[model samples]
Target chain A: MINEGCRLMVVDDELIVCKRLKQILEKAGYDVTVFNNGEDAVKKLELESYDIIVTDLKMEGVDGMKILETAKRKNPDTRVIMITGFAETETAREAFRKGVFDFISKPVEIDTIKQVIIKAQKEISGSKT
Target chain B: MRLRIWHKMIIGMAIPSFIALLGVLLSYGYIDDVQKRHGYEQIADNINDHVLEVRQNENYFFHFKNGRFLDKLHKAILDLKNSVNKISSYTVEEIGKEDFALLQDAIRTYPPLINDLYDNYLEETNVTEKVRAEGRKLESFVAEKNRTSELTSSFILHLRLLEKNYMLFRNEKSFNALNSKLTEMKKLTPHCFECNPYIEAIHNLFETYKKSDALVAEIQLTGDRLEEITRRMAQRERQRIGSFLTKTKLLLAAALVLLSTLGPLFVYKTATYIVAPIIRLAEITKKISEGNMTLRAPLREHDETYFLATSFNTMLDKLQLTYNSLERSIELLNEKQAQLVDSEKRASIGLLVAGVAHELNNPLYNISLTVDAMKDELNELTEEKISEYIEDISSQSKRAHDIIDNLLDFARARKSTEMEKQNIVRIVKESFNLVANQMRINNIKLEQDLPDEPLFIKGNHSKLEQILVSILTNAIQAMKGNGTLRVSLRPDPESNRIVLKISDNGQGIPEEEIRNIFEPFFTTKPVGQGTGLGLSVCRSLVREHNGEIEVESKLGEGTTVTLKFPQYKENA
Candidate 1:
């Protein structure tokens, strides 16, 4: 079971994709915060702690990779997942090596993402216990 | 006309005048010779009569002296002496002589005999009276005889002197007269000897007068006869020459007439033949200068002028051919200009359509994503009452996405990229995937007769795929939602080309409009539902790979579009 109050950040330059992801995650009983750019997401993350961060790989200023590096250094317990429309394998491999938790291809089915979020919550709770 | 007449008249008059002059000259020569000969004959007769008288005088003087009538004899001898002297003086003056012997004999004997007769008359006075009477009678007879002898002697002496003077005068006069006659004859015939014979005869007479008066008279008669014969011959020659001159003049007149009259006629005919044709050729050349190339003149003679006509005709033929070729080229240029204008209009329209489609795509994509999220949210609602709403939203969102995707695909103006070897079959399959649902919606039975083997072509993959999709979509749409569509792909063995054919069993395009279907903005569909650029774009794409597209359609039957792409040969 996942805590409904755990905060998660969703960042994407496209307003529609960002809004959709926030709505879906809110329906699934999690507190979600949405930002239209990587810079805004990074500013919010510096002010408060988020349990998990899901971000678009391509964004204006302060990309997902840079946010991941800064968030991990500021708070080592925070988990980050990279999301992109382009499914380039080399970039996925590089993200994995850089300590990103997971990579997701866009036009992603809602059920698959829900399963991935549940599994990631279990792992976070187990680590805390 | 007057000049010609003048020429003829002058020729005629000159010829007659020349003949008459020649005749007159010949007659004048004959008359002069005859007159000279007659004068010579008269002089000769006079000399002969004088010689006979001198002979009679000598005979009478000798007879009276023999009869012893001394006084009567003296008177007779004096008379005879006077006659001899007259003859001698005539001979000496009329005829040139070294000596007049007849006159000398009469002078020497008669003067001595007359003196002797006078002495005898004084001594014989007392002789017998009877005898004296008889002697007186005899003396009277003797006196008559002696007077005749003296008269004869004086006549002979006068005749000798006259003959000498006459001979000298005749010699000088005849020489001068013969020279004058010879000069006149020379004008006619150059040589005349009628007076020459007379001169020679006179010289012979003078020589003979020294020997005997009778011999002188004989020589003069011979000379006179020769002169008469020469005169007759000269007259005959002059008459013959006059006739010959008249004949020559007539012949010359005839020759003049022939030359003058015939010369102009020959000249006129020659000028007509030569100069007339040349003038006509010059007129034809003027016509040609005025651009009347059809003008031609007849060639009369095979000469340089005729050769010029042939060359001119050949040049005209070349000029006409060149002008005709120029006209044809101008016509071709006009046709090319018309085609260029038509192409430019189509290109402008294509650019406008592409711009409108591009503008609509991005916003339509955002709306589709928002609808998808709403559908998902509806599905997760716990109330079964909203299940229908969820299904409706999902289906509508899918439809909206499909419409936007189709619009985007149509609007995308993709420039052809670099060529690479690509599997043509894979491209075709991808194009089919894009149009499969439309095929289902149309209930069109789609059949693809594509080769299983990987067929490779050198072209841009995206452009080839677009070409396939456009043609297939057209075929399916032509079925009008319920017909059969067949796409056939095959390799042309002879040309090493790949051929693609799409056919539909629905209503066909009109035969008249089939040719225009590949033209941009030419469409049979309702406005806004169809952009006519589909077939046109397909054609352009195929052509980019050096390919060609063609359509065959018949009214109420079917339509088929065939695309042929040349196979890429590495060596080529």
Candidate 2:
């Protein structure tokens, strides 16, 4: 049961996309926060610890790729799922190599995110144990 | 005649040698005739000298009355006779008819006339003895009778005077005076028995004297005629020699002229016939060896030169054939080398494209995830339009992912494993949908004429879609995003094929580059805008479906691409 209190963060350039993702993740019983841009997301990353980070791959400044890097540096155990309107194999590979939790594309499916969130919760608990 | 070179040479040398031999022979004959004429003249002069010697001996005998002179004259005459006989025999071959006749007459008349003069002198001696006997008888009778007879003594005196005149004078007048005195002495004789004896003796002496004088005059005339004939024979001999010399001169002149002119001419002609063709063939051989394969020896005569020229030309023909085949092989080798270089270049570009294509996948996946999330949230919305908007976004993201997959497939040059019998019209419509938005935004007019019946083809669905989309994208771009584009699909029953044509009214390819359009990496597009492999990849995909693609274009006018695929059969 992934309804146990888990802290999550979502980053994207599109406010609607970020808001929608945040809503879906909250309904799935995870404490989730959303950012419309990577600049605020990187500030959040320095102050707090998150169990999972979901960020868009492309952005205006301090892009989701940089946020992914900052999240992994602050806490190696943090799991990240990168989202983007346009997907690239190289950027996805780069995100994974930097210790991202997973990668997903836009027009995202709820079932797919649910599966990913469930998997991330198990991984975090497994690491604690 | 078809004379060979050797035959001509032989004749050329033979002619002059023959002429020279003939000239030599003719000169020999001319010299021989001159020698014979000289011999005849010497013989004739010797005969004249011998006759003159016989005449001088005869004159010595007549004037001296010596037996030794007569003997010498007879020997000289016999010697003259022997010379005349020798000359007559010599003239029998060399002299002409009239001269031979004169020599024969002179020989016959001279000996008989000289013998008749000797016979006349013997007759005169007998007549003198008879006359002297008669006179002695009369003188004895007159002394015994003691008769002082004046007539008898005067007759004896006349008889003695006539005998002296006959011996001293050769003229007719002196001989007539002697005869008249003898006649007067005869008339004075008495007609008695004693006078009859004296008259008979006187008549006998007168008859004998007249016969001897006539024979001597005939001999002298025959000797003069013999001398005249001998002189005429010598003159005829000189005339004959002169004519022979003139004839020989003409003959020698003709031989000289022929040797000088015709000999050289014949030699030159033969040399030209034999050697000129050989020289020409040598020149042509040199030209051919120097790489002028087109040259050949000129053939004119049907001689040895003709055979040589024909053979040379045959060799040239074979050489030209070999050279042409060698050239063709070199050209083919060069073409294969170029193809190898082109394929190597394509392989490198393919690797670069693969790298780029792999990087694109993540972005597409991100877009799909976002759309899926949005669609799931919108499921609770009551507004029908909001649900439709969410569905549209979802489908568009799926299309974008599909495009990236297609790019990866293209970069690796991979053919899809799954193929199906699909409607070609549906494929075209789906492909057109992908580019239709861009065309609309750019003000490009799109026209399509598809048959009502579904035309099916055997091909992978995604690959077929890729082919149509690639062609449509090119057409749209070529039209500068604002021009008429026509697309048509129809069954070409004649060929049992389905034909698809995509045409645009835009800047078309140049004529020179049209043939290179199918080569990988060949393109007219600016850098970064095209990978230059669009048409080449399109053609390869079409070929994989057992289809053919062809492009036609005119610069500044338009471009049309026609794709044909064999119709799928039920049994097949």
Which candidate has the highest TM-score of all? 2
TM-score of chain A of 2: 0.91
Expressed as tens digits, the lDDT of each residue in B399-474 for candidate 1 is 5566457545643554447898878877887666566545533446778899999877889876776677667767
Model 2: residues >4 Å from true position, as ranges? A1-129, B1-3, B52-75, B87-91, B111-239, B276-324, B334-572
Local accuracy of candidate 2 as per-residue lDDT tens digits, B1-572: 56677787898789887997898798779778877876776676676676677668767755653557667867876786787676655455675556556656755665565566566556656666765666566656655554645455556656556655665673567667766765665565534345445456545555655554454455445445555555555666666677767767777887788888977887887787788889889888898888888998998756777887898889888988998999999899667644543454354344334433433443344454445655655666557646654665566466656655544444444345476788999878766655554464344787889988899988877667667766777787788745899999999999999999999999999999999998977878877666676777777778888999999999989999999998988867
The DockQ of each candidate is: 0.07, 0.09
Interface RMSD of each: 11.4, 8.7
What clash count goes with each model? 83, 30
Each candidate's root-mean-square deviation in Å?
26.1, 18.2
Query: Predicted candidate 2: what Cα RMSD to the true structure?
Result: 18.2
| Chain A TM-score of prediction number 1 | 0.91
- Predicted structure with the largest lDDT when compared to the true one: 2
Q: What CAPRI grade goes to candidate 2? A: incorrect
